[model samples]
Target chain A: MIEVEALTKRYGSTLAVDDLSFTVRPGLVTGFLGPNGAGKSTTMRMVVGLDHPTSGTATINGRPYAASPAPLREVGALIDAKDVHGGRSARNHLRAVARSNGLPDSRVDTVLGLTGLDAVAGRRIKGFSLGMGQRLGIATALLGDPGVVMFDEPVNGLDPEGILWIRNLLRGLAAEGRTVLVSSHLMSEMAQTADHLIVIGRGRLLADLSMTDFLEQNGRTHVQVKSPRQDDLAPLLRAAGGTVEPDHDVLAVHGLTCEQVGDIAAAHGLALHQLFEQRASLEAAFMDMTRDSVEYGSGSLPPPPDSALPPPPDSPDRPGATEVAP
Target chain B: MTLPASPTANAASPFALDGPVHHPTTLDVVRSEWLKLRTVRSTFWTLAVTVVVMVGFSVLVCAAQVATWDQLTAEEQQANPINGVSSALAGLSLAQLAVVVLGVMVISSEYSTGGIRSTFTAVPRRARVVVGKAVVLGLSTLVVGLVASFVAFFVGQLILATKHFDVALGDPDVLRAVLGSGLYLAACSLFGLGIGLIVRNTGGGVTISVAALFVLPPLTALIPGTVGDQIQKFITSNAGQSVAATGSAPDRLGPWVGYLVFTVWWLVLIGVGTWLVRRRDV
Candidate 1:
C-alpha cells in the first residue's frame, strides 16, 4: 500500500500540491484522475520521496521511503518516461538503476525481455523513440519487481497497441494484489480500466468512489416522451405521479419509467412517436462534479479514445456532479 | 481540500520486505557508477585525449627544452633543468576541460533528462548514490590519469636522453611530479563533479566549473599583492600545479599547502552538493 498524508509542496509562492492526501490500496487498479495543473505528478513525486513535502509526508507500506532499505524492490515507479541518460544504452541504464538496489545482472535482462526491449537493449537511449523510451521506463520500474507500482501519464504518447499493452500490464499487476496507482487526464480510459476512481481537481479530492457507486450515486433517471398530443398526455402523466418539463415537441418526464410513460400515453389515447429513458453520461457527470475544480478548463474537443463509454455529466460546483443518490 | 495520506501513516508496523537491508549498498552503487562511466562514449574519448595529450605534449616540450639548453647559463639550466616539466604539463590545462565536462555531465544530465527522479527513486538515500559515484569516478579517473602522466614522463625523459638532460624516476621529485600530477587532475575533475551536483544543470554546472578553475585564478591574480596571495593560494587547479612541481616558481605556492588549498575548494563545493542532493527535489 502507498500512503500519502497531508502532503504539500511549495515552489516560492505557488503551492504545487496543497495538503494532498490519497491512498493506493493493494489488489486493484486505482486511476488517479485530474485535469492539468492538478498536482498529480507533484503528488506522485512526494510519494516516491523525490520531492520532499513541505508540510506532511508520504510512504510506502509502512515506513518512510528514505527509511526503506530496498526501495527499488518495494516501490517501483515510472515518474518520467525520458528519465534515462541519453548517452547510455538501454541495457546500461537499467543496469545502473538495478545495481543501485543491489539486484543481480540477470534481473536487468529479465526486465528487458519482459518489456520486449531485448532487441534494442544495447542501443543508446538517445536513439529511442518516445514509445521505446516509455518501454525502458517501464522496464526500470519492474526491475526489482516491487509490490507497488506507480506510473505518471503512462499512455501520454502511446499508439493504440502500446496503450492496450499497458492497460493489460497494469491490470495484471493489480491482479497479483499489488498496489497500482496510474494517473491520466482521460475519463474514458478510467471508465474502462479503473475499479476504483480517485478523482481530484485543484489539488483537492472531488470523489473517492467505486465505478459502480459513482454511477449509482449520480443516477438521474428520467424519461422522454414525444408525441403530437403531449399537451393532453402532460396532465395525464403528472396526475399519474410524474414531473413534466414540456418542450416544443417532447415532454421531459421524470419520476416515471419509460414503460409507464408509454402506458400512460396509450391509456390516455395519445399517440406517442418516441418514448425513452435517459440518464446523464459518465463524462458529463464527471464534468459536473469537477466544474469548479478544473485548473485548465479548455473548450477544445477531447481526442476520442478507444473506449465506447460516453462522457460523464458536467461536474457541478458542489460535488459528484449533482449526485442524486437513488 | 482532501489531502493525500500523511507521511505518518503505517509508521509502526515493520514489513518483512522492508528494513536497512533493502536500501542500496556501497558496493552496488560503485558498480552502478562504473556502468554509468563506461556507457558514455564521451568518457572514453575524454580519457583517450587526456592520455594522448599528456604523452605527446610531454615529448614535444621536453625536446624543445633540450634544444634550447645551449643558450642558457649553467645556473639557469640547473635550477629549471626539467624545462618547467610541471609547466610542460600545460596539456593538463586543456585536459582538465574534458574532466570538468565529464564530471558535470554525470550529475546534470540526470536533471536535463529528468532521470534524476528515476535514480533517486531507486536509491532513496540520495547522498550515498552521489558519494558512491564520486568515489568510483575519482578512483578510476585518478588511476587512468596516473598511467597517462607516468607514460608521458618516461617518454619525455627518453627524448631528453640525447641532450643529456634525462631525468630518472629516482630523482627527488620526478616520480612525485608524475604521480601527483595525475592525482591533481583527478581531484580537479572531482571538484567539477561536486559543482555539478549542486548546480544540477548542464549549462550552470559547466559554467561554474570553467569559471572556478579557468577564469577565477587569472582574475584573482590581478587582485594586487597579499590579498591575492591569500585567495589564489586555494584555487584548485592553480594550487594543484604548484603541489606537483618539483621546484617552485618565484610566485608559485608551496606543494603541501597547495594540496590543502585544492582540498578546501572541493570540500566546500562537495559539501554544498551533498546537502542539496539530500534535501532538495531531484
Candidate 2:
C-alpha cells in the first residue's frame, strides 16, 4: 500500500500539488485521473522520493520510500519512458537496475521476455521506437518484482496491441495482491481498467470513489421520447416538471424517469412511438466534473450551468475536501 | 506493432514477491555503475582516444627532438639537455583533454539523456549514486591512465635512446615522474567528473572544465609579480601537472604538495554536487 498524506509541492511561485492526500490500496488498479498540468506526474515523483515534497509525507508500506531496506524490491516506478540511457542496450539497462537492488541477472531476462523485449534486448535503446522504449520502461519497472508498482502515463506511445497488453499486465499485477497505481488523462481508458479512481483538477482532489459509485453519483440520466405528435407532448412533459428539449425527432427529458414519462403520456392520451432511459456515459460525467477545474481550458467557451459545476473549493459540500480514513 | 497474445505469461513466476529482499550496499551500487560505464560506446571511444593521444605525442615529440639534436650548438645542447621523464610524458598535456571529456561525460550524459532519474530511482540515496560513479570512474581511469603512461614512457624512451640521450627508469626521480603522470591523468578525470556533476549538462560541463584546466592556467600568467605566482601555483592544471614534471622549480609548487591541492579541488566540487543532488528535483 502507498499512503500519501497532505502532500504538497511548489515550484517557485506555482503550487503544482496543493495539499493532496490519498491512499492507493492493494489488490486493485487505482486510476489517478487529472487534466493536463494537474500534477499527476509530480505526485508520483514525490511518492518515489524523486522530487522532494514541500510539506507532508509519502510512505510506501508503512515507511518512507528511501527508508526501505531495498527500495526497488519494495516499490518500483516507471515515472518516464524516456528516462533510460539511450546509449545502453536494453539488457544492460535492466542489468544495472537489477544489480542495484541485488537482484539476480536471470531476472533481467525474465522481464525482457515478459515485456516482449527479448528479441531486441541486445539493441541500443536509442534505436528503439517509442513503443519499444515504453516496453523497456515497463521491463525496468518489473525487474525487481516489487510489491507496489506505479506508472505515469504508461500508454503514451503504445500501439493498440501494446495498450491491451499493458491493461492485462496491470490487471494481472493487481490480481496478485500488488498495489498498482496508473495515471492517465483518458477517462475512457480508466473506465475499462480501473476498479477505483482518484480524480484531480487544478492540483486539488475532486473525487475519490469506486468505479460503480463514480458512475452512479456523477453520471446524469435522461429519457428519450419520440412521438408522432411531438409538438403536443413537449408542452405536457415541460408542465409535468421535466426539463424538455427537442432534438430532431425526439424529446430529451431530464429530471424524470422513463416510467413516469410513459405514465404521463398515457394519461394525456398521447401516442408514443419510442421511449427509453439514457444514462450519460462515464466520459461525459468525467468531463462535467472537471470542466471548472481544467488548467488550460479554452477561454472563449461559455461556462457550464451552475448545477453542472462541482461545489466551490471553500464550500463545505465539496467531496474529497477532507481526508477519508482507510 | 504485433505482440504475443500472452506477453505476461511468466509474470507470475518471475515476480515472486514473497522472496526475501536484499538491501543494496555501496558495493552493489559500484557494481551497477561499473556495468553502466562499460556498456556505453562513448566510454570505450574516449578512453581509447586518450591512450592513443598520450602514446602518439610521446613518440612524435621524441622523434622530432632526435631529428634536431645534431643542429643545436654545443652551448645550446648543454643548457637544454634532453630529460627522459619529461620527454616520454610530453603527450600528457593533450591526453588530459580526452580524460576530462570522458570524466564529464560519465555523469553529464545521464543528465542530458534523462537517465539520471532511472539511476536515482534504482538507488534513492542520491549521494550513494554519485559516490558509486566516482568509484567506478576513478578505478577504470586509473587503470587506463597507468597503461597509457607506461607505454608512452617505453616507446618515447626507445626513440630517444636512438640518439643516446635516453634516461633509465632506474635514474633518480624518473620512475616517480612516470607513475605521477598516470596519477595526474586520473586526477584530471575526477576533476572533469566533479565539474560534470555540478553543471549537469555535457556542453556546459565540458566548456567549464576546459576553461578551468586550460584557459584559466594561461590567463593567470598575465597577472604580474608574487600575486600572479601564488595564483598560478594554485590553478588546477598547474598544481596537478607539477606531479608529472621531472624536477622542482623555484616558482612552482612541489610535486606531492601540488597534487594534494589538486585532489582537494575535485573533492570539494563532488561534495557540493552530492548536496545539491539531494535537494534538486529530477
Candidate 3:
C-alpha cells in the first residue's frame, strides 16, 4: 500500500502538487487520472523519493520510501520510459538496477524475458523503438519483484500490442496482491483496467472513488425511447418528470429509469419500437467531473454549468480536506 | 512466443530477497557503479583514446627530438631540455580532454538519456550515487593515467636513449613528476565529473570543464601585471601543472601544494553538486 498524506510540492512560485492525500491499496489496479501538468508525475516522483515533498509525506507499505532498506525490492517505479542510458543494452541496464538493490544477475534475464525484450536484450537502447523503450522500463520496474509498483503514463507511446501487453501486465501484477498504481489521461483506458481511481486536476483531488461508484455518480444512466409516435410520447415522458431530448424519431430521457419511461409510453398507448438504457460512459463521466479542474482546458467551449457538479464530499481540495473513499 | 513466468511466483529464483530488505552497502553501490561505467562504449573509447594520446605524444616527441639531435646547437639543445617522463606525458595536455569527456559523460549522459531517474530510484540515497560515481570514475581514471604515464615514460626514455640524454625512473624528481602527472590526470577527470554533476547537461558540462582547464588559464594571462601572475598560479591548469613539472621554480608553488589546490577544486565542485542533487527534483 502507498499512503500519501498532505503531499505538497511547489516549484518556485508554481504549486506542482497541492495538499494531495490518498491511499493506493493492494489487490486492485488503482488508476491515477489527471490531465497534463496535473501533478501526477510529480506525485509519483515524490512517492518514490525522486522529488522531495514540500510539506507532506508519502510512504510505501508503512515507512517513507527512502527509509525502506531495499528501495527497489520494496517499491518499483517507472517514472519515465525513456529514463535509461541509451548507450547501454537492455540487459546491462536491468543488471545495474538489480545489482544496486542487492538483486542477483539472473533476475535481469528473467525480467528481460518477461518484458519480451530477451530477443533484443543485447542491442543498445538507443536503437530501440519507443514501444521497446517502454518495455525496457517495465522490465526494470519488475526486475526486483517489489510489492508496490507505480507507472507514470505507461502507455503514452505504444502500439496496440504493446498497450494490450501493458494492460495485462498491470492486471497480472495486481492479481498477485501487489499494489499497482498506473497513471493515465485517458479514462477509456482506465475504465477497462482500473478497479479504483484517484483523480486530480489543477493539482487538487477531484475524485477518489471506485470505478463503479464514479460511473454511477457521474455517468448518468438514461433511457432512449424510439417510437412510431414520438411526438405523442415526448410530452408524456416529460410530464412524467423525465427530461427529454428529441433526436429525429427517438427521445433521450434522463432522470428516470427505462421501466418508468416504458410505463409512461404504454399508458399513452404509444407504439414503442425500442427502449434501451444508455449507460453513461466513464470517459464522459470523467470529463464532466474534471472539466472545471483542468488547468489547460481549451477555452473554445463555455464553462460547464456549476450546478451540474457538486464537490465530492471526500475530495481533498486543500490540507485537512475530507477523506472520502468509495 | 514464450511468456516468462511471473516474477513473484518464481520460487526457483536464486535471488529471492524475502524476509527483510537490507540497504545496499557502499561497496554494493560502488560495484554497481563499476558496472555502469564499464558497460558503456563512451567510457571505454574515451579512456582508450586518452591513453593513446598520452603515450602516443610521448613517442612522437621523443622520435622528433632524437632525429634532430645532430642538427641542434649545443645551447639550443640544452635550453630545450626533455625530461624523460615529462616528454612522454606531454600528450596529456591534449589527452586530458578525453578524461574530461569521460568525467562529464559519466553524470551528464544520465540526465540526457533520462537514466538519472532510474538511478535515483534504485539508490534513493542521492549522495551515495554521486559518491559511487566519483569513486568509480576517479579510481578508473587514476589507474589508466598511471599505466599510460608509465608506458609513455618508458617509450620516450627509449627514444631519448638513442640520443644519449635518457633519464631513468629512479633519476632525481623523475618518479614524483611521472607519478604526479597520473594523479593530475585523475584529478582532471574528477574535476570534469564534478562539473558534469553540477550542469547535468552534456554540452554545458563539457564546455565549462574545458574552459576551466584550458580556456581560463590563457584568459587569465591577458589580465595585466602581477595580478595576472598571481591569478595564473591558482588557475586550475597552472596549479595542476606544478605537480607535473620535474623541478620547482622560485615563483611557483610546491608540487604537492599544487595537487592539493587542484584536488580541493574538484572536491568543492562535487560537494556542491551533490548537495544540489539531493535537494533538486529529478
Candidate 4:
C-alpha cells in the first residue's frame, strides 16, 4: 500500500502539486490521470525521494521510501525515459543497478529476457529508440520483482503490439496482488484497463474514487421522443414537471419515466416515429467530471446544435444511470 | 534467492525509491563507479593519451637536450645545470591535461548525459557515491602514472646514453624525482576529479582545470617577487611539479609539501561539491 498525505510541491512560485491525499490499495490497477504539466511527474519524483516535497509526506507500506533497506525489492518505478545513460549497454546498465541491492549477477539476464531485450542486451542505449528505451526502463523497474510497480507514460511511443503487451503485463502484475499505478491521459485506454481512477488537475486532487462510482456520479441521462403531435405532449410534460428541449423534430425530456412518456403520448393520440433512451458513455462521464478541472483549455467555440438530439431521462438511459450496482 | 511472502525490511527501512536499490555499500558504489568510468569510450583514449604523451614527449625532450649537451661551453653548462634524467620525466605539464579530462569525465559525463539521476537513485547517499568514485579513479591513475613516469624516465635515459648523460634510480635525489613525478600526475588527476564534481559540467570543469594547472602558473611567475611566489605556491601545477625537481628552489616548497597543498585543494573542492550534491535537486 502507498499512502500520500497532504503532499504538496512548489517549483518556485508555481504550485506544481497541492494538498494531494490518497491511498493506493493492493491488487488493483489505479489510473492516475492528468494533462501535461499537471504535476504527475513531480508527484512521482517526490514519492521516490528524487525531489524533496515542499510539504507533506509519501510512504510505501507505511514508511518513507528512503528509509527502506532494500528499496529495489519494495517498489519499482519507471518514472520516465530520461533516467538512463545513453552510452552503457542495456545488459551492463541493468547489471549496475542490480548489484546495488545485493542482487546476484544472474538477475540481470532475467530482466533482459523479461523485457524481450535479450536479443539486443549488449547494444548501447544511445542507439535505442524511444520504444526500446522504455523497454530498458521497464526491465530496470522489474529487476527486483517488488510489490509495487508504477509506470509514467509507459505506452508513449509503443507500437500496437507493444501497447497490448504492456497492458496485459500490468494486469498480470496486479492480479498477483501487487499495487499498480499507471498514469496516462488516454481515457479510452484507462477505461478498459484501470480498476480505479485517481484524477487530478491544476496540481490538485479533483476526484479520487473507484471506476464504477465515478461513472455513477458523473454522466447524464435523458429520454428522446419524436411525435407529430409533440406540441400537445409539451403541456403534459410540463404538468409532469419534466424539463423539455426541442431538438429538431423531437422533444428531449428529462425527469420523467419511459412509461409516463408513452402514456402521455398515447393520451394525446400522437403518432410517434421514434421513442428511445440514452445514457452517456464512460468517455463522456470522464469529460464531464474533469471538464472544469481540465488544466489545458482548448477554448474552442461550442458546437452548433444538430437535429439528432440526445434522449430524454424518461427513456431507458435514465435507468442506466439511476440503477446502482450492489 | 527465494521471494519471501512479504519483504521483511524492518528497522527503519531507508532504501525504498519505487525503483533502483539504495544504501549500497561503499564497495558496491565503487564497483559501479569503476564500471561507469571505463564503459565510456572517452576514458580509455584520454588515459592512453596521458601515457603516450608522458612517455613519448619526455623521451623526445630528453633526446633533444642530449643532442646539444656536448656543444654547451663549460661555464654555460654549469649555469644551465643539466639533469637530463629528471627533465625527461618533465612532460607532466602536457600530460596533466589528459588526466584532467579523464577526471572531469568521471563525474561531468553523468550531468551531460542525465545519468546522475540513475546513479543517485541506485545510491542515494551522495557523499559515499563521490568517495567511491574518488577511490577507484585515484588508485587507477596512481598506478598508471607510476608506470608511465617510470617508463618515460628509463626510455629518456637510454636515449641520452651516447651523449654521456644518464640517470640512475639510485642516484642522489633521482629516486625522489622519479617517485615524485608519478605522485604529481596522480594528484593532478584527483585535482581534476574535484573540479569535475564542483563544476558538474564538462566544458566548465575541463576549462578551469586546464587553465589553473597549465595556463596560469607560468604566466603568474612573470609578475615577480611576493605575488609570483604566492601564486606559484598555491598553483597545483607549480607546487605539484616540485616532486620531479632534482633540487628545490628557495621559494618553491619541498616536493611532499607541494603534494599536500595540491591534495588539500582537491579535498576542499570535493567537500563543497558533495554538499551541493546532497542539497540540490538532480
The full ranking of all candidates by DockQ, starting with the best, is 2, 1, 3, 4
Judging by DockQ, tell me the better candidate of 3 and 4: 3
Roughly what TM-score does model 4 have, to 2 decimal places?
Answer: 0.85
Model 2 clash tally?
0
Summarize candidate 4's per-residue lDDT along A154-235 as a digit string, tens digits. Answer: 9888998888988988887777778899887666678778889998776789888888786666545678888888888888
Estimate candidate 4's alpha-carbon lDDT, on a 0 to 1 scale.
Answer: 0.77
lDDT of 2 by residue, B40-128 (tens): 98899989988998899899889999999899999999998888778888888888888889889999888878898899898999888
**Model 2 local distance difference test score:** 0.85
Clashing residue pairs for model 3: A83-B114
Q: Give the 10-residue window scoring lowest on summed lDDT in candidate 4 chain B.
A: B8-17
Q: Is the docking of candidate 1 incorrect, acceptable, medium or high quality?
A: acceptable
Model 4's DockQ score: 0.29
Pairwise lDDT winner, candidates 1 and 3: 3
| Root-mean-square deviation of candidate 2 | 6.7
Candidate achieving higher lDDT, 3 or 4: 3
lDDT for A218 in candidate 2 is 62
Q: Order of all candidates by lDDT, from best down to worst? A: 2, 3, 1, 4
Supply the DockQ value of model 3: 0.41
Report the number of the highest-lDDT candidate. 2
Best by TM-score: 2
